[model samples]
Target: MSFEKENIPSGVGGNMADVKKSGYLKKLKTMRKKFFVLRGESSTGPARLEYYDNEKKFRTGSLTKRTIYLRSCFNINRKSDGKNKCALALYTRDDCFAMVADDEETLSEWLQALLEQQQAGLDGAPVPAFGKCLSSQLSTYGKLWWKPKGLGSSKNLSGNYRLCLTSTTINLVKMNCENEDWEFSVSQITSNVGMCCMCNTCI
Candidate 1:
């Protein structure tokens, strides 16, 4: 359930697969505490954050699949929508962390910085990606029966697909294994042919 690490090399027969955190494993990989310093626009001086643990500890290195698509799922909420705008909330899968900035302007700056970083992450995807990871946040995803244009009615195109849509891209992932996927960019779309983009579902 954690990041994949290098397995210990055995002489010949390695029974380490069944062993969970054995003494021999501890000698090779020792747990450690890492320190992080946060520099924000607030005048409250630099903040020091530390993560110390054994099982679910954070590590520094290349971005994983979860981190790459983090913005697509994670949400940043402003605590107060009316008056007090200095507080911001970061949401995880099961936890919400709130922090107060020095002032409203600082809070705005922090929010802008986080949004920029999320967008920049899309542009910085590593080559030979684990798979086809999206560079932008996915706004909508759903499965539907797609109909291709032809002489007959909409009943002929029986291709089932899952549509993935972002701000700039539209992708169709095939259902089962019969049809191939099709992807299109916003710029590639042409409206000169009226009623070109039509949708119909299979009964």
Candidate 2:
């Protein structure tokens, strides 16, 4: 017996939306400029190293201005990081890309172009772009204990602290009349595989 049905539910297929077509749409808007010695860092490979298209068949990735945040390489402290000096950085929340040009002049030109696009996007000018809003989302919270150094083992058993996880940082407060408050970066958290942050003798 053939039980498979071709038709779907009313609410399921009606709400479907079209995917982003920014990729090919952007290429058509910008005109090809005749420039000499235009070099850019490869998206994949060593950090800030000189990149060349060793293979004849190579395609460079393009960025949409609204999705990325741009910063001049000079603004970033790259001394200990081993990043190239003559470079421009473009990043989103999840990914980062650094491009290096031949000279300072070339790098400046690239930076200027990126900034111009960014400003245009901010001004509400139409450009092929994609981005997300993070401000409206709510943060999750959980009960956790914070034990001070030199505190006795008996104090750890009380479980008096409540930790609130925010978008950027962790807000911890002692659940008592004092209402002691503490805030720290989410990156400072260290945890085990099976175990959570709540328990006796938590750091």
Candidate 3:
């Protein structure tokens, strides 16, 4: 005996929707961790120091010119235990690249020298030869984050974000759309009532 069965239409659309939702949820979780939670230090460092690169190979001997921005964080006093952070965002045209720093004085000194070199218009001068030194400083509670401004939105969103820098800390604060307000507490750092300074956003 042969039996006939009714055919059911495939629910491919439903399955696709489920997959998309799951992917989105995973992305959201990753963003939350990146922007909110502090997961200690990241192990990645700057890419290999390259002076020049051909289509399929690297030209290590050729003198290459490029413009780069240095974003750094460091401590002010060499003996202090507190976290001090400062950043130098310079539009530099140079032949080398470097990493961030740990202590404030060392970072400041290196930045000062680089700025001087950039002003001198030296040929074949390294962009950031002090990268290792900078990295050492950064490993000691310093964090560096950068984005190509030309590739990012040109919107004037200063009202949506705030940056706080001190002899011991660097804080980036932004409004939370979910709560319709600023974050309750500033991450791992405690907000001092009398020491807090209002920025453009706070006003």
Candidate 1's TM-score reads 0.30
Per-residue alpha-carbon lDDT of model 1 for 1-203, expressed as tens digits?
A: 21111221221332222221111001011222222112221232111111122212223222111121223313444554353446654433223344555566766765555544444444544321111323333444545665565311333434665555567755555554423556667565443233134455331
Instruction: Sort every candidate by TM-score, greatest first.
Output: 1, 2, 3
List model 2 lDDT by residue over 157-176, tens digit each. 23455444556665544544
Model 1 segments more than 4 A misplaced: 1-135, 150-158, 190-197, 201-203
- RMSD in order of candidates: 14.8, 17.7, 22.0
lDDT-superior candidate, 2 or 3: 2
Count of clashes in candidate 3: 11
Poorest 10 consecutive residues by lDDT, candidate 2: 19-28
Predict model 2's lDDT versus the native: 0.31
| Sort order, lDDT high to low | 1, 2, 3
Q: Could you tell me how far off, in angstroms, the CA of residue 21 lies in candidate 2 after the best superposition?
A: 21
What's the TM-score of every candidate structure?
0.30, 0.28, 0.20
lDDT score for residue 155 of model 3: 23
lDDT values, one for every candidate = 0.36, 0.31, 0.25
Q: Could you tell me which 10 consecutive residues in candidate 3 have the lowest summed lDDT?
A: 18-27
**lDDT for each residue of candidate 3 in 1-203, tens digit (9 for 90 to 100):** 10111221113221122110011001111112110000111122111111112311111222222212222211111222233243333211111122234445645664554433333322343423222233223222222222323211232223343333343444333322212112222332354442233222221
